[model samples]
Target: MKKFTAHKKRVAITTAALVAIGGGAAFAYWTSTGSGTGSATTGTTVPFTVTSTTATGGPLTPGGPSQVVEFEVTNPSTGVQRLQNVIVTVADEDGILWTDAGGCSYKDYFVSDAVFTAGDVAPNGGKVTGTVTIKMNNLATNQDACKGLAVPLHFSAS
Candidate 1:
């Protein structure tokens, strides 16, 4: 009976470890402070406007069974501002999506690949802009796709 109890303990410990390893960041966030509101891709109010957006180059590749997306932002904020270090989350009819750290090139990534500082949207927010690239392979590349698939990119502060 003692041996049986020991065996059960080992199994339980192993199972707990597997669950934790599988938890990943999503789990970490949940286990921690849970949910918190943050930034949106598009800034609003009379204070700021994204201004313009342009693609620096063509697709990174043949989509790599996934797509590498890039974003260009123009700051027109009338107040002091800095890029928010965070995770850009997108959810659509397909499901949820995001870029991993490897997909990130910018600094101040408190989570995933979110960049927090490029320039500043100060008393006269900088025309400040930068690029964030993420691979979208989980989505289907079928003939028929969901119309207006919503991608909500969220960010956190450093």
Candidate 2:
């Protein structure tokens, strides 16, 4: 009877030891290191559209009162943009003919460039107003060549 009891005790102790070892192995994991690469793209900018709105102080005679040229700018871009100033000039159209047969050219006119720190325009069809001045410079020659003629003005902004 003593020999049989000792044998049963050894079997129970061996089974417990095997369960503990297997449970520890189940919780174990492997450690490792790794790396990868990625990339992204950017967007482009679009130009603003500027148009003449109205003209005040004009009968536009030679050496007459200067006209206040009012204009509006449209921001067609997706983001807001800054406007520094607007440069006004006469369009170079060779088709321009004076009311009289006498010759009239862009040299006979003067347009003042506008300079102002305007507010940032909003995105997508936003508008802002600005002004410049235009006058027919009084030349020593006969000025009747420009009488009753409509002058074409060009506007550009930064």
Candidate 3:
């Protein structure tokens, strides 16, 4: 009986050792490399809107005090827009290049362009104010054709 019991214990120990070795071997794996691909998209940029607000100096007179032309810029885009400068030009009543008539035209006026420090305008409804001086230059010739005529100004922003 003693001999039979010892043989049984030896058999169980050998089976357990075989299981531990086999279990470790079962987890072993081969290392290798592979690859694949991906994709994406982007958005678009738009222009700004400039509008004249009011004039602070005067009804222009030849060789008289210059008027400060006040204006504002509107950012209609969804993202912040960069503002660099605002340029004011004398436009016809129809907002185009003035045509010479009775000696009154764009050539008779001088406008100082307004420059701004580079700044970011907020998205949508963001506004910034600027001013340019407009003067009727004292020409050597007559400018009576401009008397009582409403000056139309065109504003642009960049």
| Maximum-TM-score candidate | 3
Candidate 1 residue lDDT tens string, 4-109: 9999999999999998888753533344456778875864443333322332343322233233334434445565665554334453223335333333221211
Candidate 2 local lDDT, residue 73: 86
Candidate 1 to truth, TM: 0.32
> Deviation in angstroms for 11 in model 2?
18
lDDT values of the candidates?
0.41, 0.78, 0.80
Best-to-worst TM-score order: 3, 2, 1
lDDT of 2 by residue, 30-51 (tens): 9999999988976576788887
Best of the two (2, 3) by TM-score: 3
What's the CA error at residue 30 for candidate 3, in Å?
6.6
Q: Predicted candidate 2: what Cα RMSD to the true structure?
A: 5.9
Report the Cα RMSD per candidate.
Answer: 30.8, 5.9, 4.3
Error of 3 at 112 (Å): 1.1
Number of the predicted model whose lDDT against the real structure is largest: 3
What digit string (tens of lDDT, one per residue) describes model 3 on residues 1-158?
A: 98999999999999999998988775568999999888776557678887775778767898898888677788899889899877678886456877456668887789887845458999988988777888988999888898877677877677
